[model samples]
Target: MLTCDHPFPLDQYDDRVKEHLRFTGFYHASQIGIVQCQKALVNALVERWHPNTHTFHLPIGECAVTLEDMAMILGLPTDGLPVTGITMSNFETLEAECLHQFEIAPRKSNYRGSGIKLTWLRDLKERLQLTDENNIQSIGQYSWGSACLAHLYRALCRASRFDCKEIDDPLTLLLVWAWIRLPYLAPVPREPRSFPLANM
Candidate 1:
């Protein structure tokens, strides 16, 4: 299975930076500490997943992760419009957008097709003044919850195919939801439950 191994950087940031992340709707997500991906459980769920219907076909009944789960488990805002946008297919368009939003135009080499390198993004994030009201406002307007849930759905759909071997989605959110809803399949949470259930 594909692993989500990134660290939580919110703890490392100063209060000012944390406030900026909060304003941009990433504060709760950033607060989630990394948890081991439950591979066996995830794989079993994948096998039961019906991409056509977007639900798990368990013996009990059909169920799917709802937007409410995203809001409660991940603390994502689910009331906004669906996250949708046109692709920036060319380097020039991508560069211009980056310059406009991030105020730093990465070199063409830093981009692979339409996506920029994570390393480059990390570097830019460090260099940019996140406290700047303009930058915070630019990012805060999007429906981050919808964007996250959409990507997770897309990843689950792709991984449900017989030809696919690995999942590249937010497994933490999925696992937490499963644990809360299906206690029999869950390990005892080492910590007490918290606001974002995933943090427990």
Candidate 2:
């Protein structure tokens, strides 16, 4: 399974930045601790995934993660502008966006095709300041929950392919959703679920 290990240091931010995060619907998501993925369970679930229907084919019935699950599990906004944009664009545009969003210019070495390394993102989180208040706050206008669900669906579709050997994406959301809905397949939560269900 492919995993993403970039953890945000939310506590390092000041109250102002923290408030911005809450305002942008990311505070609860940022609170989620590292989840212990059960690879066997995940593999089993993937085997049941139906890319055509975007649902799991279980003996009981078909079920799938929805926008509501994204909101409940990750505290991301479910309603707003869709998270759609030009992904593969000119390097100059990409550089401009990076500078606008994180206020740091990335070197060409940071490029991975059209995107920069996750390390750059992690570095920005460590040093991000709300210098451009409106610009940063504008991100709160997008439906991040929808974006997450879309990404998960796309990842599932690709991973379910016959020759696909590994799954890549944030598996935490999927695992948590499964844990909540399919208890028999879940690990016992280390503690009670907090505000965002992923915090369990």
Candidate 3:
């Protein structure tokens, strides 16, 4: 799994953002390429989501517009968006909101070390299957997990610039969560471990 100790640097140039999104996990999965899907997603966002301000930096890197701002920009009603009680105060709240939306069970009390497993991947794929295939295919020929992760990473990356104030639709947020969180749980290695001769 990719280990990013810090949040992505949204203050950087567009090229830098593109590089991080595309090449960071380029070869991690065979189902689809990260770079290709990112471009497609960007295109969709550009076409569908209008920025509140006339300046690109204002909308893209400084602060995210709230759901109200989004509605104003898109000329849509805000009544349809669900208001999440969790705020972006910290990672825990963000994670909790995501877990709740995906219906991922909490960690067992008896759990010992790292809880990563194949079951997470299975559950993620199942959720993706419930989404529209056209939406899924727009990104790439990615598995449910890969597509979900890409979307989440992009959303968070976009959210980072906006002081974590963006209000997206609950369904949209759920989809992004599935993409971002699912890929982090890498498939468990199947090969057996070898023991040292000294142990025998």
Candidate 4:
């Protein structure tokens, strides 16, 4: 139930990405902290996913997404090493990100934001067993609706059988979508990336 029929926005980064981190109850980074924490996050995630590398396509605005470009965009270090489509923890955790910035009053009479695509995320949040006692929607609005894609990718990873120390397969992208697209914890930009999802 971790993922179903959705894709994680592995490449997207919101300008207020820290707000998403806050959703996971991780809002202690300042300007430097923002950059530092993101770098740390990327390093930790990349290390875990290094074993699974995929030759996937990544398109940036008006250009192809190189590792350096990704580093610049996401505040990651340019180690010259390629990146996995995903990394880090799944959406379910003790972490709780507050939703004041998103104008989400989970405790209010009614919550906000709606769209046909968003229905999947709302469902995914329920599947993850998150609550809304403290204006906590778990998933925020930074990301339009990429969880459904991640869900689908997770299914693919589960179905694929690959052995390591043999053929190098970038199957982590398929495997770690849920972990990477964690609602607010894994917030993407409110505005869609200029790159097309189909390009990937």
Q: What do the candidate models score in CA lDDT, each in turn?
A: 0.79, 0.80, 0.33, 0.30
Candidates by TM-score, descending order: 2, 1, 3, 4
The ten-residue window of minimal lDDT in model 1 covers 2-11
lDDT of 2 by residue, 1-200 (tens): 53333333345657887788888988888777777666776787788999899999989999999988899998899999988987756679988987776667888988877778877777776665567778768889999999999888888888778787777666888888888889887777777867698887
lDDT of 2 at 76: 90
Per-residue lDDT of candidate 3, residues 1-200 (tens digit) = 11111222112325543443343332222211111123233333333333444122323353333433322222222342232332354445544654775655434431223333345545564454334445333333323333332344455445435344442222233223223333353233233321210011
On lDDT, the leading prediction is 2
lDDT of 4 by residue, 1-200 (tens): 11122323333335555555555322321121111123333333333332144223223212112433332233322332232333323222111221323322233222222212344445445444333435444333222123323332343334333421111112222222322333344445444543222111
Select the stronger candidate by lDDT from 1 and 2.
Answer: 2
Q: After superposing candidate 3, which stretches have Cα over 4 Å from the reference?
A: 1-35, 38-78, 87-104, 108-200
Q: Tens digit of lDDT per residue, candidate 1, span 62-180?
A: 99998889988888777654668788888999899888878789897899767887779888877766555785676777777777777878888988877877786577788888898
- Tell me the TM-score of model 4: 0.18
Query: Which portions of model 2 miss their true places by more than 4 Å?
Result: 1-11, 89-93, 99-105
Best by TM-score: 2
Off by over 4 Å in 4: 1-98, 105-117, 120-200
Per model, how many backbone clashes are there?
Answer: 0, 0, 6, 17
List of clashing residue pairs for candidate 3: 63-162, 64-162, 148-179, 148-180, 149-179, 149-180
In model 1, how large is the Cα lDDT of residue 55?
90
Q: What is the lDDT of residue 39 in candidate 3?
A: 29
Reference-based TM-score of each model: 0.84, 0.84, 0.21, 0.18
